[model samples]
Structures are given as C-alpha cells and as structure tokens.
Target: MADKMLQGKVAVVGAGAKNLGGLISRTLGADGASIVVHYHSASTKTPADETVRAVEASGGKAFAMQGDLTKVEHVVKLFDETIKRYGRLDIAVNTVGKVLKKPFIETTEKDYDEMFAINAKAAYFFIQEAGKRMNEGGKIITILTSLLAAFTGLYSTYAGSKASVEHFTRAAAKEFGPRGISVTSVAPGPMDTPFFYPAESPEAVAYHKSQSMNGKLTDISDIVPIVKFLATDGWWITGQTIFANGGYTTR
Candidate 1:
C-alpha cells in the first residue's frame, strides 16, 4: 500500500478557523502536515490566527486566509494562495456549511438559493479547484450532515442542499480517480457546536440527542479523527459519504 502518513504533506482546510475545522487543522499539523487555514467571516480572523499558531506550535508551517467560498473567485484564490505559500497541495478538507430548519412551505426562494450556494455550490468549486491544483494521490473531503439519511422534515432546504454534495463527491471521485486523487464526503450527526443551536429548539435538541448513542450530540472531537483518517489512513475510501453521526442516522 502507498504510505498514508501525512508527514511532509500540505493541506488546505476551508472554514478551518474554528470548531471542527480548527481541530482538524491542529490535528493534521500535529501529524506533520503544513496547513493553509481558510476562514470566512471577519469575525473568524482571530480564531484563524490562533489555529495557525497552534499548527506552528506543532512544528508544522501554517498561515491563515479569509474568503467567502460561495464565490468562485474566492475559492480559486484560496487554492492559489495555498500553492503560492506551500508550493504543493496534498489534501483539501472543506468544513463549510449552513444550517436552516424551516418547513418547506415557509422556505423562501432566497433561502433555498442561499442554502444551495453555501452548502452545495461552495463544495463543488472547492473540489474542482482542489482537483486542479493538488498533487497526485491527494485527498479531498467535505463536511456534510447526518440529516441526509433521516426520514424527517423541517430541514428541507438545509438537508436538500447538503444532499447535492453526495453526487458531487461521486462524480469528482470518478473524474479525479485517474489522477490518484480521492474524493469523499463526511456526514456528521447533529454536533454540539454554536452552528447547531440557532436553528434548533430545546425539545428538538433533546430529540436529536435521544436518537444518538449516549443520548448526546456529536462533538467536534468525535468527528475530527474520522476526517484525519480519511485524509491519511482511510485514503482507500472514496466516492462515498461516511456517516460519523454516532449512530444517529444511517443509510
């Protein structure tokens, strides 16, 4: 088998300033990969800087960049800057996503467009750009949601938009396979992040927790190792969505 260790590899982590993204950056850095940490909002700059510091502390080179990845230009610049700074790209992991839990009837056209833009469009371009710029044998992963497997409602837009990424993963994997690039998506269950609370009510949160093992939500810690695995040891897995939702939902 090809060596799967991350040592000497270069990685670009989208939305990598905080939460799950931050942890993934730090973990990969600890494993000896240079990092390009991408954050979106101005508010995320501090976290991005902190993540870069953490990577550097781990003896891996790293720097922070900001971009609204829903824009293709920004996505292009993100990979371009990674190449400029590091000279090569071996892994790209996109943790960019948006969540909305509204009834189908209540979802506006604007909401649908925005959700698809952030969840689907951004992911597509990220993969496309990574495939264009990465070295042979690179790995690409996108963060998705476990809701894609649930027989539920109230998240029509959020889940539907994320659902599109599964197909993108498959197509990209096929097209990029000949180049030795592996493409995959990860669907983590309802995680305990600020990102999960805004759209959830108390009771709904409780219900989500009840469905998972230990009657608790997924943690950022729980998911990062899975991502790290994909980027390294799990390189054999491609063209599929691995649900790491603590048994909360599955196909």
Candidate 2:
C-alpha cells in the first residue's frame, strides 16, 4: 500500500484563518505538510497569521494569503501563489461558505446570488485551479453543510447553494482520478461556530443538538480528523460527500 503520510507535502487551505479551516491547516502542518493559509477578509488576517505561526511552531513551513474566492481571478491568484511559494501542491481544502436562514419567499435575488457565488462558484473554481496546479496523488476537500441531506425548510438558499458542491465533487473526482488526485466534500451538522449562531435561533440550535449524538452540536474538532483522513489514508474514498455531523442528518 502507498504510504499516506503528509510529511513534506504542500497544502493550500482556503478560509483557513479560523474555525474548521484553521484547525485543518494546523493539523496538517503538525503532520509535516507546508501550508498556504488563505483568509477571506481583513478581519481574518490575524487568525490567518496565527494559524501560520502555529504551523511554523510545529516545524512546518507556512504563510498567509488573502483573497475573495468568489472571484475567479482571486481563486487563480490563490493557487498561483501556492505553487510559486511551495514549488508543488499536494492538497487543497476549501472551507469558504455563507449561510442564510431566510424563507425562500423572502430570499432576495442578491441573497441567492451571493450564496451561490461563495458556496458554489468559488468551489468550482477552487477545484478547477487545484486540479490544474496539483501534482499526482493530490487531495481536494470542501466543507459543506449536512443540511444538504435534511428534509427541512427555512434554509432554502443555504442548503440549495451547498448542494451544488456534491456534483462538483463527483465530476472533479472523475476527471482528476486518472491523475491520481482525489476529490471529496465533508458535510458537518450544525456546528457551534459564530457562523451558525447568527443564522439560527435558540430554539433551532437546541433542536439541532437534540438530533445529533451526545445532545451537542458538532465541533470543529469533530470534523477535522475526517478531513485529514481524506487528505491521507482515506484517499480511496472520493467523489462522495461524507457527513461528519454525529448523525445529525443522514441519507
């Protein structure tokens, strides 16, 4: 069997300034991969720098990059800088997303466009650029929401936008397979992040916790190992959305 260790590999983590993305970057860096930590906004720069510092402190090489991934040029620049700095790309993980809990009736065109731009369009270009830049045996993972599997309402734009990533994962897996690249998505349940709290009510948060095991929301810790696996030994499992939501929702 091929060794799955990440030592000496190069990884680009999109939205890697904090939360799940931050953890993934640090985890992989600890395992010996050089990291390109990409943050989306100026406010995220500190966290991005912190993540890079953690990586370097772990004895791995790292640096921070900033870009609005909704723009293809920015996406291109992201990968371009990764290759320019690292000399090779081995893993790409995208955690860029925006959530909206408005009713479909109340959702404006702007809301829908912005949701798709961040969740769908950005994801597509990320995969496209990664495929172009990555060497053989590379891995690409995207963060999606388990809401994609739920039979519910009130998240029409949120869920609907993320749903598009499944197909992108499938197609990328097929196209990139011959080159020894693996593509996949990880869908976490209602995570206990600021990102989730803003869009959810207290009642909805409680309900989400009840549906998962241990009566708690998914933590960033819960999802990172699964992503790390996909980037390493779990390479054989591609073209699928793996739900790591503690049984919050399943197909």
Return the lDDT, model 2, position 128.
Answer: 98
- Candidate 1 lDDT over residue span 1-251, tens digit each: 64688999999999998999999999999899999999999999999999999999888889999999999999999999999988999999999999998989999999999999999999999999999998888999999999999999899989999999999999999999988888999999999999999999899999999998899999999999999999988989999999998899988
The TM-score, computed over Cα atoms with residue i paired to residue i, of candidate 2 is: 0.98
Write the residue-wise lDDT of candidate 2 on 89-171 in tens digits.
99999999999998879999999999999999999999999999989899999999999989999999889989999999999
Q: Model 1 lDDT vs. the true structure?
A: 0.94
The models' CA-based lDDT, in order, is 0.94, 0.94
Ten contiguous residues with the weakest lDDT in model 2: 1-10
Which pairs in model 1 have colliding backbones?
Answer: none
Per-candidate alpha-carbon RMSD to the true structure:
0.8, 0.8
